[model samples]
Target chain A: MKRFLVVGSRDLTEYVNGKYVPLVVEELRAKGHDVTLFLIENGVIAARDGSKAGKVLNGLSDKGARVYAEDVSCRARGVQTLASGISFSNLDFLADSIAEGFDNIVWY
Target chain B: MGKTEPPGSKKKKTQKVAIILSTGSYQREAPTTVLRLAEKLLERDIEVNVFAFEEAVTLTNRDQIEHNEPPSLRKVLGDRHVYVGKFVDQLLRVGLHGAKMDWVTCVLCAQERGVENHQIGGSIVGTLGDLWKFVRGADHVIAIPTYR
Candidate 1:
């Protein structure tokens, strides 16, 4: 399966553009591609437990897509707790991922 | 002894990242985020190429000044507010000692914003061709749009 690293920097509050990340992730998962959703900056808001965006992420997680929220971004926004299946990551991981090579890298 | 290849005959296979930044500073956090990411990438010795277009061209304006906060808001705003240009300059300086970084400001965009002649010392005034060159050479690409 082709590997994908999708980075989202916007939060759900910006509904118009924010929705595309989840939508695209869902489609990629449906096609059985390996996908990693990396939420950074304000995008970490989607990892907060009990939020609508969190629910969507949870659903995506259940579908087998790996979801991660940047640790610094989460702390900056005071998002201490995360939804189930979402893990905390750092820019090091991002850099390493890019170094390791991905079939596709998408940024939002 | 093995035959020596000509100097500079082969290009180094260094990992490179291209960041397309279309957003300006102060109004949003995207430029700050781009700077942070660029620093982190450089720490890993990844070459960074930043293609700044639209309002992002204003980020490299050398005329940026940090003024003291107004007396009324000084308590919360601190004595002086740091400008994004300072950070950009610092990053460029740091990159000089380690992994290289090219901060290219679109010529058309800079002219539109009247920052063509005011760009920081290290930043290059480039055409759209330079943007495509960065994209073509980079192993990874990150685009920070103007909207968000």
Candidate 2:
């Protein structure tokens, strides 16, 4: 089981709507791989309450994949409250994850 | 003490690097970045393989275009190391015909799209399975997907 860190720098409208990165996350998880979704930039909006893409993210979170939103990105956009099951993260944490040797790092 | 070995006794292993470029030429930094990375890798004696998918097919057939001081992608990727997706390349061809790399358009993709013309030189018909094999066999694989 390879470890994967998926970085999302785009918003949900451009990302989940196109069904590329989200589908990749779902498919990788289905294949029994360890996957983490790291949302940055406008991607933080995807994990907020009552968002169209947040619903999909929530489902993915329940399906055994961890979801995180970057702290600064959320704050810059005035997003203080994240949806249930979503957590805050930063690039340092991402760097540490890479230093710990994740098999693959995919940025979308 | 270490034993002295003869020159050329150990064969150097070539690292296979595969890159998937899905963006079109001049769309953004990705198109040029892929070529730059490939050039750097090639300079280090690494084996570079590029798979151009989606709108990136325009890059394979596009003539010399200079934008914002970027090097010519066609000259950088060279002739034999690049591969263009057949379906998109054929659909978007402007008859410029300067591609020097290999073209592997899947038969199924062509048939599904009702594409019958395969007139471009340095082109071939292949399958998704072949591309998968190329990627899986590489030591490193980097995919620069479309921004849209």
Model 1: per-residue Cα lDDT over B92-120, one tens digit each: 99876898889999999999999999999
The reply for model 1, stretches above 4 Å from the true place, is B1-14, B71-77
Chain A only, candidate 1, TM-score: 0.95
Per-model DockQ against the true two-chain complex: 0.22, 0.04
Q: Which stretches of candidate 2 lie over 4 Å from their true place?
A: A15-17, B1-148
User: What is the iRMS for every candidate structure?
Assistant: 13.3, 15.4
B20-84: candidate 2 lDDT, tens digit per residue: 76676457545554554454444444555566566655554433233332346547654343333
Candidate 2: tens digits of C-alpha lDDT, residues A43-93:
888888777778888888887777888776787788787776677876555
Top-DockQ structure, candidate number = 1
Candidate 2 docking: what grade? incorrect
Error of 1 at B137 (Å): 1.1
